[model samples]
Target chain A: MLKNLLMALFVVMQGAAFAEIAVIVHPSQGAAISQDDISRVFMGRSGDIAGETFIPVNLADSHPAKAHFDQAVLGRSSSQIKAYWSRLVFTGKGTPPKEVGSDSEVLTLVAKNPNIIGYVPLSMVDDSVRVVATF
Target chain B: MQCTKFVWVPALFVASTVSAVDFQYGGFLTVGAGTIIDKKESAYDYEGFNCPCFISDFNTAGLYERGDIGWKQDTRLGLQGTVRFQPGLSLTAQGVARGSDSSVNLEWLYLSYDLTNEITLQVGRKRIPLYYYSDFQDVGLAYIWARPTQALYGWEASNYNGASVRYATFSGHWEIQASAFAGNETVRKSGFARIYDEVNQDIRWRNILGADLEVTRDWFTARVVYLQSDNSITDKPDSADFSRPADKQRVFGLALNADFNDWLILSEFNTNTRKSRDEELSIPAPAMSVGVGRRIGAWTPFINYARFWEKSKDADYENERFIDLSATLRYDITSSSAFKFQINRFSDRSEFQFVGATTLLSANYNLVF
Candidate 1:
């Protein structure tokens, strides 16, 4: 029984380590978006992209994809991200992105809003949203 | 002040009943304890407090006395709520319950409107933007130190009734934020005054005008600020030594900070000048703090040095000088909380031994929810 449990844990860790994050936007968003733009938007440094205000959405912190996205795109750990936002939030300087529960919820929200941007595991990408970048 | 405790309750209830309003509430907590581990043989007398004492928090008059472990010096709870009436307009209110005074004080009540995507206008009560961390100093979780170095953060008044305009935008590879503010503040029974005198003293900063600019690129950040105001003091018991007429005061400050993943550096310098109308008394006080830290996984160890010195042209005026050296270790308990332990060595170099010399050991658990 212990061997089986160990095998299952190793498989889960391998899956998490190899998973890729895909940045997504509404299909209606036609303008070219760069990685820098996505980084700025997610960091609350800027909201403008291609002369339009872009709203960034986030997956809940509990989601594995959230950790993957944070490490791959923002180059920050979950603790660092929380600390960064705490400075902005307590000072009333900025607010973090709105959060949704899962990849499906993120896709649904992005599909309904032309300006909303989000991220999910590459395997969860669907026809409702366009994948802008993958890492 | 009894009504202050229930102020947010009504606002929360109103927001809940209004279908169009979006309400969000959060809070921060710090449970801190400290003691004077070592001290000079002679007591340093200053009004109500004496030797073997360390002022852990100068703004709130938080002091750790002789031998007993004190939790009231740094413990506090703060709540903040934002009621968004619309996409561009919102109201924010914050209140803090302090362990030192055992009182709930309303700290911020401001109305903010987005004039443009890059510009914001705010009106009402807000923290005096005197330093980089002044706005969020009460939220201990936001900073790596157990407390801001007292050599610089100690002040007469912390908040003001003010109006300010803030602008934020990206310039090439730099992220820039700038603001200009003007207001006035009056503090009753000022904590800063209590350090020197036993009487209840009132202090006022009138026509307070200030501006600041901050720019960041990658791992580096720089900030500069300038402020000027008319300051005056009045003693409740009519003490001749404490009361001063309106004097012109100006302050200039700068900060340079860098965070390169594993390595971090934080530094700040400030100079303040107060001149009397007759030009007989001119006091210039300069203070600086430098801190460096290295992050290894969830543990970060830091060391810091801070100093405050006052130089007066008049030889008769006694100069006040002090230095603080601290070492701290912080452990991230989770994303929303942290545990920190710090040791401080405070040395009094003043002509009169203003606050005495002592070594302190302190710890805190900080969290935001």
Candidate 2:
């Protein structure tokens, strides 16, 4: 009885957790990209995507969406990711995606920049940016 | 270099009253004490306590405490960038001084240039790719009570000066990354003894040149490190070589790490060999360490066994072994800081000339801006 109860709770709780993040871009973006391409864009570690000049934008460190984006999209801890990026930044070898604040801010920026890709909460979804992937 | 200025710099000023990038920092501090349980006697004169905490000082020849224990501090303060920088280019650096060192040496300075989709060209004086912990061994960031046995197999200088080129390939469930480095190495050792007015005693091995490589794939990472130096080490024994040509020495190491979710296992074996007449006259030294750790939520507990052996034509030459352990727990109170605590034990088997066996225990509080 206890095992079944625990399993039910686990399943119910899993439903509440998000599985993927929506990678949004300005409505102006017409590029038909791939899944691997999307991962590269968000990791900020990628140099190019499908030959198109695209830039990945990150949410501010403290934003709630940042957590969803990290686990659902980036698949890393905030600390591990930062350690990963500092290795690039301090050396002048690479720059990560641009960072913006708030779901509304990211949506507005994506709605405006054709080459920009960002993430936001599902509720904030709108016509300004397209959902590139569930994650 | 064109859009070089901080892109996130303006975001801080435009946002709220307190900017994340403005740099606010604080850290926790913990101290502890412990006792030496066992020892073998040698005229070398040294300490052999295996408590890994930073608090205990001065190596006692060979003394054991019945239930000996004391304060432990794994405390650290740091600065973390909150605004977040662009992916292609960024700037970062850190300074830490939690132990006996007077100040935090410049830990990392480099330019990470993404050459292609998979290759990253990082050039500058960053941590030498010696072993896994070689990268984040700082007390402020390292989550382990003590570094893994494979990384600190021996008492080796932790950092190197040089540029590293790293490449990585990622697929669905698998990932691979490799790094190679070319850099200058520096190390120091010093001691003094006095005889009658006409006689004086001094001994030391001050510095060297080194390089190392690391490669990793899903669940496994391997590393090799080499350090070479001439007798030109910064300090020389006063009674010895005033003009004697410096001798050459090499430290070679190899290790592997395996991670299966919350449980991670690691092993390392290394040997330090010196090639010079002076070395032969002194001793052939080699060291090894093996350790394992597990992560539970924000807390992790680990244990390691290490030994450093030195051989000279002289028999009763001193060889020492150390046992270390600690439980480290951290709860990320926020994005820039975390609360941490550590318990440790250090011990030595034989007291070699001047090198005594002692024990230490500590707790650490760390803060990052």
Predicted structure with the largest lDDT when compared to the true one? 1
Model 2 chain B worst lDDT run, 10 consecutive residues: B189-198
Q: Each candidate's chain B TM-score?
A: 0.92, 0.63
Off by over 4 Å in 1: A1-11, B1-19, B39-41, B239-244
State the lDDT of candidate 1 residue by residue for B12-103, as single tens digits. 22433454556777888999999887745445456657566888776677888777799998999998888878777899999999898667
TM-score for chain B in model 1:
0.92
Best by TM-score: 1
Looking at model 1, the pairs that clash are none
Worst 10 residues of 1 chain A by lDDT: A98-107
Candidate 2 has an lDDT of 0.50
TM-score of chain A of each: 0.89, 0.77
TM-scores for every candidate against the unseen true structure: 0.92, 0.68
TM-score of 2: 0.68
Deviation (Å) of B324 in candidate 2: 3.1
> Model 1 Cα displacement at B243 (Å)?
4.6
